[model samples]
Target: MSEFRDSGTFQGERMPKRPNIVWFLAIGATLTGVAMPMGTPAIAVSAITSHPNQKSDPPSDRIAAAMRAYLRDLAAKEQFTGTALVVRRGEVLVRAAAGAADAEEDIPNRPDTVFRIASVTKQFTSMLVLKLRDRGLLGLEDRVCPYLIPGYIRTCPQAWRPITIREILTHTSGIPDIQQLPGFYIKLSQPTTTRELIQRFVNKPLDFKPGTSWKYSNSGYILAGAIIQAVTRKPYGTVLHEEITGPLSLRHTGYSRRNPPAGYAKGYFTVGSPAPPINGSQAFSATGIYANADDIVRWDRSFGAHTVAPPATVKQAFTPQAPCPSNGCLNLPSSAYAFGWLVDRLHGHRLRYHPGLLQGYAASNMYLPDDDIAVVVLSNVEETDTNGIARHLATMALKSASAHDH
Candidate 1:
C-alpha cells in the first residue's frame, strides 16, 4: 500500500516576490536567453524572485527561450528525469525531459514516457464525482453513509453527520486521515477491499465537523470513490476510463496498478534504484493514478472545453469553498486550494493547478484561465519540485502572452 501524504501540503510553498529583473525587463523591453550554465541555480532564483508588472510584457521568443533555459538549468541541478510542458491556447511553449527513465538500462527519459502522477489524481476524482452530481447520479449534499458499507459507520455514529459529498470533495469532511493512523505504511501494502478499506479508517472520530473547516484528507476521497462505485456499480478505474479518459481519448491516463502498461518510467526514491512498489489496491482513488505531461495538458483544457463536466460545475470546483464562519479562512498569501486545485495568481493572472507527490514520483499541472495557458511537469525522480518548475514556466508563458497581446 502506498503511504500517501496530502500532496497539497508540499514543503517550501512560496509567496509572490519581485526580483532584480523587473526594471531590467520593463526598461529594456526585451529578453535575451541568459548565457548562464545549465546547472546554475541562478535561473531558478531569478524565476522565483523576479516579479513583473501586469502590463510589462517581454518578447515571446525571449520568454520561451528563458523558460527552456530555466528547465535546462533545473535538470542539471536536480538531475530531473521526466517531462515538462507549458501550453497556452493549445500552443506548446516548452516541452523538455531530462535524465534516464531506467538508469541501469541507460534509457533516456522522453516527453511520452509515463510516470505515476500521484495525488494529482485527486483532481480527476473530484471531476468525476462532480460530473456524477451534475448528471443527478449523486448529490453534493447527499449523506455518504447510504453509499458506504453498513455497520462500518456504526463505529462512529456520534461523529458521522452523514458526511456530505461536498464535504468530502472540499476536504472539509470530518474524517481523519487513515494514513496518519498507526502502522499505516505497514497496512498500506496489504491487499484490502473497498468495504474493508472504509471500515478500517471510518471508526475514528472526525478531525473536525463536516462543512465547518478545512483539512486535507485522503480518506474523504476514499469515501467519494466508494460512493461512486456504489452509485454507478462500476469500478473506480472503469468509471474514470469510460467517462473521462475515453471521452477525451486521453491515450495515456489511468490507474498505474490496475491497468499496467508498457513504457512506465521507473519511479525512484534513490537516483540509481527503483522505489519499492506498493499495492495499488490500497491506494484506490485517493492517490493511485498515472499519466504523462502530454495527456495531463488535455485534462487541463477539459476545463475550457467542458468535455467532462459542465463549465458551471467545473467553475464551482475551481471556486474556493466558504470557510468556517467563526474561525475565518487561513491567512495564506501565496495560494489556496479549492476542491482539487491550487488557485493562485501569477503577475495578476489567475492560475488553477494541482501538485501530486508519491514515493518515487512528483507531478504538477497548472492552467491560467485568463491567459489560456497550461503547464505540466512530471518526473520519475522524487523532490523534483514539479510544482515550482511548473509555476516558473507559467510566469514565462504569461510574460510572452502579455507581450503578444500588447
Candidate 2:
C-alpha cells in the first residue's frame, strides 16, 4: 500500500544547471554488466539533450561507470537493494545491480533478477485495454458496468453504472483504493478470486462521480481486469500474455508463476527483515506483473517503435487525460494521469512514468519520450526511493550526453 503512494512522486527541487552527482546521491544501487548489443548503431548523444550536432558521441562507458559508482554506494548504505537499467535510444547505457536479492541465501541481485513490479502492472493493463479498442472489441468511452461479466459480478453497483473505460484507465473513476478498505493487508495473505476482490469495493459508494475527480484506485484497475475478462472471455492473465508479453517476446515479464522463476528476488522490509507475503492474485491487474530490467527495456522499446498498438492509440495512452494536483493522487506537481502512466515535465522534457510498490518490492519505470531515454529501477527493499534515483539517473544521462556534444 505504501508503494502505491510512494512510487511516483519526485520530491527534489527543480533541476540544477548540471548534474549534481553528490547531491543526487544523498537523495538515492550495484555495478554489474554493461551490454552494447553488436550491430546496434550509436545514438547521437546530442539528441538526448535536444542539442543538434556539435561533436561526436561520447563513450557510454563513462556514464555507465558514474552510475555504477552511484549505485554501489547506495547498496553499501542499504538504500537500494535490486536492479537498475537505463537505456537511451535503444542502447543500454547502464545495466547494474546492487545489494542482495536474497540476503539469507547470499544471492546478489542481477540485471535479470525478477521483482514483483507492483502497480507498474497498471501500464500493461492499460495497454491491454488499448489493444482491445484497437481491435474494435471495445470503445474507451463505453460504460464499464455493462461489461462486467455476470458470472463474476452478479450485478454492477448502481453507482458504477456511469463509469467509463477511459475514466478507469486515467485513474479518474473515483473508486476507493482497495488498500483503503478495512483489513486489506490481512486480505493480501489470503488467496482471493477477482470477483471476490471486486465485491470488497463494489458495494461502496463512489468516492466521487466518475470522471469528475481524480484518485489513485486499484479498484478502478480491478474493474478494468473484470471488464477485460468479460469482453475477451479469457482470464486477464491469459489475455495479457496473448496480447502484450507474448507478442513482444518479453521472456521474463508477466503474472507470477505458481513457482517462482529463476532469478526471482525475494522482497524485504527496510529494517533488514523479510516483508509480508502477498497473494499475487490479490494484486491482479493492478500490481501482479513481474519483470527484470532487460525485459522492461524491450517493453519500453515497443512504445518508441509503436509496435504494441497503432501509433495513434499509443499516443493517446501517453497523452494527458486527467489533471492531478501536486499534493493530490500522485504528489507530482503539475502532473496529469495518462492512462496507466503519469505525465509531467522534468527540466522541459516530456516525461512519462509509473511507479509500483507492493510490500517488499518497489519499482520505477520512467521514459523521456522526447529524448528516447528509459530508466527502470526495481528494488526488493520496501519504501526505497526508486523514483528519485530514476529521475537523477535520467538527468545525469541527459547532462552527460550533452557535455560530450559541447
Candidate 3:
C-alpha cells in the first residue's frame, strides 16, 4: 500500500463522473467464426505471420505517432489509465500506456503491466468448455446442473436443470446475473468459494425460460466453471494453465483469486483515489483472469494461426448464437453474441470483441478478422470506456491499413 495523493488534475474538469455501478460492472459481448481446442503445441512466437496478400499497415512512424498521441491526449485529460496494444497483419503498430498503474507509488503504466480482465475471462472459460466438448467429455447442449461441481454441499436447483451449456455460453440461459443479486456487493467483498457463491443465487427463479431470451449472467458462467471443475476434476485456474496459458507460454496471464499479482496494476477510481475492493473469488470463472497487453496480443494471434484449434472448430465460437436486438447488447447496440465474443460489423468487416469491467479495471479486446487487426485496451480506472477506446483505435488502424492498400 502507498500513500494516496489528494491534489491533482483529477480534481479539475479532467475528473470523470462515477458511473452507475450496475451498468459499469455488467462486463459483457458476441461473435462467430471458428472454434479450436488446445492440444497442439502453442504458437509462442512474438510475431504473427502475415497472410499472403494481406495489406501492410500504414507506415509505422505515421500510425505509431497517431496512436501514441491519441493515447497521450486521453491520459492528459484523465480519460484513460492503462495500456493499449495494436497489431496489424502480425506486425506491431502501437504498444503504449497512459496514466499510472500505482498512483500512490507514482509507478507509470507500461505495456506489460497486468490488470484483471473481468468478463474477458469468459472467453478463456468458454474455450475450456469448448475444448472439453471437442474431447467428447461434454456436449454444448448438456444440462449444466449435471456437470456442476458440488461445492458448498449444494444440490442443483430445480430451475437450473434445464439450462444447457450452450445457453450459458451465449448468455441466454436466463440464470440471473450474480452481480445483480441482493447483497452482491457485500458477498463479493468477502473471500468465498465458487460453490458458496453459487449457493447464494441458486434458488432464484430463471429470468426467462432457458434459451428463450438473452440476459448477461455471470452466474451462468460460474456454473460453466463449476461444470469444468466437475468434468476435469481440476480447479478452473489449474485447467486454464494446463490447457491454454502454459501451452501458449503466456506467462503473464492467469487467474488471480484474491490479490493483485506481482507487477499487476493497482486499480483506481480516479487519479490517486483507490478503487473499491472486491474478493476476486467472487467473480470466479466469470471475471477472475488477469493479463498484460502482450499476452492478450499473443492469444489473439493463436486464433489466426490456428494454433489453438482446427479452423472449422474455431469458426464455431465466433458464429453468432444469439442475436442482439435493435437496442444493442453489451456496449455495442445490435451486436450478436457468440460463445465468448460479440459479433458485429466494423465498417463492413467482421468484428469479434468483448469488453470487461471489474472494480477499478476495464478491458476491451477486439479482433477484426478481415483486416487481421487486434486492438486491446486495458485500463485500471473503473468505468473508463476501454471498449470505446479499443474500437476507435481499431477503426483507426483499419483505416490506415486501407489507405496503404490504396
> Each prediction's Cα lDDT score?
0.68, 0.73, 0.73
- Candidate 1 regions exceeding 4 Å error are 1-58, 151-156, 187-190, 256-259, 322-335
Residue-level lDDT tens digits of model 1 in 1-406: 0111111111211212210111011122221211111121212222333335434324755786687677767666655568786776765565566666666565556556677887788898988888898778988898888777462344435567567888887778878887777776676556777777777677687888777777777888888888888888888899999888888767767874443366577778756667766566777888888777667877777778777677898788788764523332222223456777766778888878777777778888788876678888888888677877887788888878877788
TM-scores for candidates 1 onward, in order: 0.80, 0.84, 0.84
TM-score, structure 3 vs. true: 0.84
Error of 3 at 263 (Å): 2.2
lDDT of each residue in 1-406, candidate 3, tens digit only: 1112212111211212331010000001001221112121112112224324545333644665677677767776788888787877766666655667666655656556678888999988988888889989999988877676355335777777888999999999898998898888766668888878888778888899998988888988888888888888888889999989897777778886786566578887766789766577898899989887777877787787776767876788788999885677864744799989888888888999888998788999998876778888998998688999998899888877876687
lDDT of 2 by residue, 219-334 (tens): 88988888888889998879988998888777677785242465477888773688877678888888888887767767776776876788898898899999886574477544
Residue 56 of model 1, lDDT score: 30
Worst 10 residues of 1 by lDDT: 17-26
Superposition TM-score, candidate 2 onto the true structure: 0.84
Provide the global lDDT of candidate 1 against the true structure. 0.68
